[model samples]
Target: MSELGIEYQTVLGLPPVEFVHLAADLDCHHISMKVTGGGIYHHPAFSMLDDTALRQQFIAALRDRDVTISLGEGFVVRPAYELRDEAAALDVMAELGVTRVNTVTMDPDLPRSFDQFAIFTEMASDRGMTTTMEFAKSLTVTDLPTALQAVAHVGRPDFALLVDTMHAARSGNGPDDLLMLEPEWVGYIQLSDDTLAQRNPVYRDDSSDRRVPGAGEMPLVEMIAALPPVPVIGVEAPMRSLLAADTPVSECARQAVAGAREVLQAADELRETRARGCHR
Candidate 1:
């Protein structure tokens, strides 16, 4: 079974220290978070990269909880966003033992976008970190093929594709598409569920709100079963309704975990059944 981790968006706005503690409280061993620069939906407070005291505290929390970040996000490649500006932050995250960096491609120009991605990849690779790039409808790299193409353009073994389930569903891909993925190109998946009928008419906003795993129409089990051997799977079901209702973060996270566990267990069984059939 793949290790189940939580993404920063699983419970947004928590400070670094609190974030680690939450993971521990939930008995989750892995988490995805932005180690530095903040942007849309990112926590507004200064991260461990900026504050030495907070950094120490955050490290202590991770140590005490035996929790490590499964993925490091917050790298957005756009026309105006200088990828070089993230070098120091990258170094800090590497020092903290983070190995995988998640980047969003927003630049409309494919050549320029690939160039920026190459620069970012070089920086991340220099730090001994592997990188993954994901795309959304709102982003320039809008589909799985484009995202995969960008990774191909980078031409570094360390660069791979970050597949967000919601984005995959929204962008017209399916579990069958996942089966076609090159294992080498597969990074970890950000898992969630969504209806076939688009929830938000706006593409970007649609990803922000997702049903808990197994609770919606998303073919999560098939998707999970079809995935290559990924190092980690992040739970990223952020319910805007729950947040709007003043629901406790733990409750929301608990629901996501429960649903994810159920889905994963089912997927595992399906894999076994398939393997057995093949042997027959």
Candidate 2:
């Protein structure tokens, strides 16, 4: 199985320093750090007075730990606004030598304007960064088919799907959902759980329900079995869940690692079972 990672938002509300330290301690291979708007570029620690310095510092941080960043969760809300930021961000990414990004859209009800998405997609490609779209239950590209449609429409190498465990479970996406995604369209997989409730509620509240991968009721094993070869698996359990019982960063990181192992083991078991059934 591939190594696991944690989204920046998943770590019990710890500061970046604590979170990164705990992730390294837990033996995580990478971390999904968000750089939306001006967060990373404008921050005091990562303060980049201009585009050049911003990109330089960003690369230095990643290189320091040899960690790869998976950015973008709610960045597509205002594409024009976000794309402009992405242009500056990509400039840094190109100079720093980063490779991929993960982003989610705010508007899930209507078709994307394409003007904004296309702009960023093109920019990322030019900079050699792969831009993957995360499918939220509330996004225009809600399901696998719709997301695939959008990817097909954009037809850009950087424009692909970044599957979220929370959205996939909330939307009741099954193995079929994984089957529908073209192998190339899949960029990275964010794994979490809706395990708070055994029987899904009528209104499955994602915020309250998000948990570590194996801890939740998501069909993670089945989903992983169907996923194409992916480079990263992100553990992005909700912040509250990490602190709901006053868990420490170290404990949360341990849980994250345990949860990932459970999911991967389950996936292997399911695959073996299916192979047996197919032969019989």
Please provide, for model 2 over 9-91, each residue's C-alpha lDDT reduced to its tens digit, 9 standing for 90 to 100.
56634444444566777777587654432232122333232544544555555566666655534346453345656566566
Best by lDDT: 1
Candidate 1, residue 217: Cα displacement in angstroms equals 1.6
Tens digit of per-residue lDDT, candidate 1, span 75-104: 888787889999988987886778899888
Q: In model 1, where is the ten-residue run with the lowest total lDDT?
A: 36-45
Give the TM-score of each candidate.
0.94, 0.79
TM-score of 2: 0.79
Off by over 4 Å in 1: 36-44
Q: After superposition, how far is residue 211 of candidate 1 from its true place, in Å?
A: 1.3
- Whole-model Cα lDDT per candidate? 0.83, 0.64
